[model samples]
Target chain A: MTAGTEMSGPRGTLPREVPSASQDSVPLLEAKGLNVWFGRHRRQALRDVSFRLAPGQRLGLIGQSGSGKSVTALAVMGLLPDTARTTGSIRFEGRELLGAPERALAALRGRDIAMVFQEPMTALDPTMRVGRQAAEAVRLHASATSRATRRRVIEAFAEVELPDPERVADAFPHELSGGQRQRVLLATALLNRPRLILCDEPTTALDVTVQAHVLDLLDRSLAASGAACLFISHDLAVVARVCQDIMVVFDGAIVETGPVARLLANPSHPYTRGLIAAARLDEAAPGSRLPTVEDFLRGTGS
Target chain B: MTAVFTVDHVSQVFQPRRSALAVVALDDVSLTVGKAERWGIVGESGSGKTTLLRLLAGLERPTSGAIAFEGAELTPAGRDSQRGFQDRGLRSRVQLVFQDPRSSLDPRMTVGAIVAEPLRGRRRRAGASSLSRPDRAARTAEVLAAVGLSADAARRYPHELSGGQRQRVAIARALAPNPDILLADEPVSALDVSVRAQILNLLTDLVAQMGLTLVLVSHDLGVVRHLCDRVAVLQHGRIVETGPTEQIYARPRQPYTQELLAAVPRLPAVLPPSDERKPPRPLQK
Candidate 1:
């Protein structure tokens, strides 16, 4: 139990660096009534999704596949495909992002905001060296000399606890292990000193032990930099472990949103309750049937 | 009390292309599974857990050492080729359910054909009992229902089903042959949180009803504890610890096992007050 509690805590407990400006006024990121439609069918992928993350605050989006968590992230980053029509208000640092010019959004991206994808291999260029990639991110915003960029890249690597930072900097994505590659990807994401990091199941592909370590790394980085995060994942435990606040997404809608401890302890929505019950592997007895979401949906008419 | 399967000093080495160094996937590992026992192998990536499972399924032979089934040595030579478990009788007796059914299940094949293909292989084997088309179809429907899939699922392709249902189809395929031992590698890891529990429960029920010896490999300790009677912690091609599930979780002897257990994410133990009152701030340093 001691070990378990050590991995979990509510928000504002860490030694977080105070935000530069007043965070009480404008949130770091905010989305309102986000509705997304894909292709000619214009089928609803996300509907009326809304949330807010204050500067230095970590917000988790929890949902299963096709729940529009990733789509939400893409919508925020202004990276959604052309065919996908979106109707929503996305504000980053009090600036309207939805329907904003791509050039304007691109200027904020990698400078004020960045994203870490689930699969690091595909996110990274296999042909490019890890350090060069990190350096490139740094160079995108700042007019740094090549030498200064390399030094900053190595510093970012060290920040993420990558061992033998020099050696890791020289290696390619394929040359590194999954954990190492993830760290490199994280380094790239954080290299530009972005105000917010949109992590879409970043640690899902990693092993449990490695996942813990990476989660720790992310916590420390977030605290040190005072950057906000929109952590997205399907695992309830993982989302609860990482973020202070949680939002449960289902069928392209936000079902529940609250402080992590409160929501997990007494989930109001049947879907949230079902998700919590499903993840309770420890409490489940041997040979007993595990309660499924379908059971809740049937009982409560989801 | 009889030993259902025994792995004797198994060691597997793979030589990477253009590299002189050999990757020791499994090194001098030995284990024995008694009848009706549900055993779990837990480890992180590169821990040889999957290699051990493959070896148990007879899908791959060790470069050195031997595996015995029902007290008889399973020779990797005459009856098998590169991918082991070629003996149809042995294949039927020790079936493997993979981590991802999307990749394992053939996309073009209907669910019925995928499940019945194993029995079809068994029929081709000399001295094996052959079943009629209708009997095979009935057996397929039976196993599908056992795994909680409807009879209509047989007519659909793998792509038509959800991830959890695809895994159920995979499980049905594994059970179609009536295997004495069921080896599942991270069966529920690929599934959503809501679907995972259902799948685990299904596996637990089926294993008990069929009286099948079970070998599960997963990185999640909680799932292992929920399903397995005994547990083994593997790291870098070695069994770091092995004991009963309760005892191991209650009092882990190995430091690695302790660390692995600690790494599993648990829900925070705080319950917020009913009102929307803010939590008291911690005292500043």
Candidate 2:
């Protein structure tokens, strides 16, 4: 086994009686011992994962596809399919969410906690106008009057810096550009001023210039609302920019977790090191072999 | 000493079915690619880089302007039509490797059949190496070997191979005809990060060994920096800047080019050894 890697047990240590958790000021979201299995064969997708997000804190979940990063997000949101089995504790504002009744979870979903997905096109209803979509979040979570909801929706659009807020609200999702659509999704997520937000690769589908703008918008909104964020993505530079702390997940486990600056500077785990190496597009000498995850896995005896 | 491919004042306009506005995909774009020179076309989405590449490949005709391959004008005529051109072989000398291999490579076909597709098209023309059945098999095996794939891979279906291996098959198929110019469109974008390096190294090695001209189109400036000798930045269907790779990276002239460079994420550098390193998180009590 490679040095610095512990394979036979839980990959990460949960905070014991977190000084900053519940009593001191509850973490916006906390997950512990999250295990998920799917299908008849009972293939384990995630294994014993644990993490905590303080209020207004930004935590980046970094991993490749099929690494259980998305599954973690799903599990937290109670959006996992019926066939899949899940166990472990997920707390939102010190409230138990795992195995909560669908009625109970649905009530908290858009009002207290919200999500932004990778592809806004599929997430938004093609038939509905963008304004109605934002207003719906407010309607579902709060008892605002119709006029107030309309005003809130327009305000949300302006907050995201969408040009011509009223026109954007009136337009359908397909009518807007990729960046504009993503802004609408942000508007929906922020409509209720939720305490926490779960973003799953929200900028992956966008172009570089547009991605930069979206990242800026997300940063500004998070600051303005002071909401905790679980930002998940495959890009290291993006995570570095938006998150203060980082957790490297692999094969459904948290292989490494630490402050973003600390982990980036000196990654202890081989997987994290491999990820850092792979993301270094500028460092590789011309025509040189790029160090891959396979190289690191080979060291791990996998 | 002559240029391998030249695109002069190329303009492509797509007339929308319902809308009165005609979308200009490329606007008066001109570029010259020299023999054995590796060129990178950097642009965001809808920047007409792909359209310019399609023009060079003869896949689409420019609405205006002209493209010349090896000093001969490329016509809208299909590859089979001579159309007053002396070099009837110009069409076969240029090959394109697409972005998505799963879609590009016919899934129903075996890897061997897919790699030999280009050579089979050339078999009709009489030459010293007319590619007998055995010659085709030998060429397929040789190209596969050059791409770091085993001869056994020839028998397997596209579904049997991993994404990286499928891309290798695509590259092999592109090389089967022994084309002098190779165009790759975001070859590594769909691939996993680990496998991307291997494919890039393979491309670099192949281009050097075969002395083939390379045109790579990607949104990633880092990949461009590593593979291309020269780069052309595209914005709003126009070439805003074109220069050597080192100069472009060190000192970008255009605002768009500067934005692209700024967007490329940098790997966090290994920190200097110091006492500031905190101890690992303790296991829960």
Clashing pairs in 2: none
Question: What is candidate 2's lDDT per residue for B1-285, written digit by digit as tens?
Answer: 678788889899999899999989999999999988999999997898888888877777888888888787786434432433324565557789988898999989999999988787643322435578999999999999999999999999998988899999999999988888899988887765656776887898899989989999988888888889999999989999999998998899999999999877565566423233221221121
Q: What is each predicted model's overall lDDT from 0 to 1?
A: 0.85, 0.83
Per-residue lDDT for A165-233 in model 2, tens only? 999999999889989999999989988888889999999777677888899898888877887789999
Residue B51, candidate 1: how far off, in angstroms? 0.9
- List iRMS (one decimal) for every candidate: 4.5, 5.7
lDDT top scorer: 1
DockQ of model 1 vs. true complex: 0.38
**CAPRI grade, predicted model 2:** acceptable
Worst 10 residues of 1 chain B by lDDT: B276-285
Listed in order, the DockQ scores are 0.38, 0.35
By summed lDDT, the worst window of 10 consecutive residues in model 1 chain A runs over: A9-18
